[model samples]
Target: MSFRLNPFKVMRAVGIVAIVVYGVVLVTGYKKSKVTTTESVTKDMKIRNKDFYKSKDYKNNLTLPNQVVENNNEAVAKELEQTKPAETVDLQKDSDTSKQQTDSKVADKNKKKEEQVKLEMQKQAQQKLAEQKQQEKSKIAAKQAELKKQQQLEAARKEQAAAQARAEAARQQAREEENKKAREEAAKRARENAKKHQGSKKYIQVASVTTEASARGIAKKLGGNFYYKKTTVNGKTAYVVMSNMTDNPNTLKAMENQAKRAGSGYMIRSVGK
Candidate 1:
């Protein structure tokens, strides 16, 4: 496995090393400055003491040794006091400089940290926005797909309904055709039977009336294979409603029963008779 260096960790280590190096340099310079100041002060004092010892004032002071000694002691004391104050000012300035440098470094470090935090927050916000947009796009796509699916299903249903309608219409037309053909065949058979029995068969009469209109009305009410005929009844000119002509006794009997069910009375008679 390869070692992957984290940038943040590397940067933090570098800052720590820089701080340690700066601290060491500041401490070493401060110590060297303090030593140099002490040495310079001691050399100046030694030169002044040597000049005082070699001067004419020294020879005069020999006559008043005690007063001269006291004056020299006071002068030395004043020099030491003045030198101590200057050294203290230098030390205080060094300390203040060191403190300022430390404060500046701390401020820079804090500013960098804040910037990193802000950058991280901005990145997170952008990522969240992208995720939301993706979700919205997904929703829209899904909705479109669902809509398309529903439209297809609806179209299929409509097509199915249309197909059923067409099939039903075709079946209804076929039924109508069959019914028409059956009616035509029935009419043809009735015409042929009427021709075959003409002038040589008998008919069942269901109604005898004084008016042709009444006889026709009775025949219409009697429905199939019935007609009206002009005749005489009770010595008055009248009309009669009759069943279809037939000579078979069984057919005549069945027609007689049918006429009896349709009217109040019925009679069977030969066409010419």
Candidate 2:
């Protein structure tokens, strides 16, 4: 077999070796740094732990008197439990006898004290009830007094109302009587005035005319004395007719009716007040 030199193979091998060497160097450096950091942290932690243990707080925590007492009691109880059974039974019987006597005496004292407390509470409750009843009596008396006063006031008001009603009735009756007297006096005066004017002269106007001939014609037709009342018509002289007849209401009404039947514009006129 002939040996051949391959440049590519050599180059490839060199590259692989370089890669492995770089990896080894990286791993070694990482391990050394990690170890140094770990050592520094451990040293600091040791120093902190030592300082803490030497502090007053650590001494106080370690010196627990209650824990030591509890341990001593536990050890003593264990030892007592390990004693001979015959001796334990005799000791237990004696202790039980003494405990029962003491319990009986304590129970008697508690019962007497409870009885006294109950009596005291009952006395206080009685006193409170009596005080409440007295207060109620006072309230009732005050209410009665108020009610009586109100009733008296109401009675007075009713009496005042009755007096006012009576006064009003009397005043109304007096006003009515005065009005009746006034009406009677007015009637008397009216009758006297009627008697005084019973003969007052009166006349009726027959008709109006422009000339004497027209006046005479109307007077002849109506059977009355005719006259002229000076008046003006279109700024010229005119005359109004008159009738010389008695002031009888019936005769005036008849004349008015006759004039109305003859013409449309005829009217009756009263003369002299």
Please name the candidate that would achieve the greatest TM-score relative to the true structure. Answer: 1
For 41-153, candidate 2 gives per-residue lDDT tens digits of: 55433244557988885687578688886886788678667653321124344445545554555456555655655666676667777878988999999999999999999
lDDT of 1 by residue, 113-219 (tens): 65776676677777778889989999999999999999999999999999999999999999999999999999999989877776467776676788888888888
Off by over 4 Å in 2: 1-124, 199-273
Q: What TM-score does prediction 2 earn?
A: 0.30
Alpha-carbon lDDT of model 2: 0.64
lDDT at residue 79 of model 1 (Cα atoms): 81
| Residue 158 alpha-carbon offset, candidate 2, angstroms | 2.7
Q: lDDT of all the models against the reference?
A: 0.76, 0.64
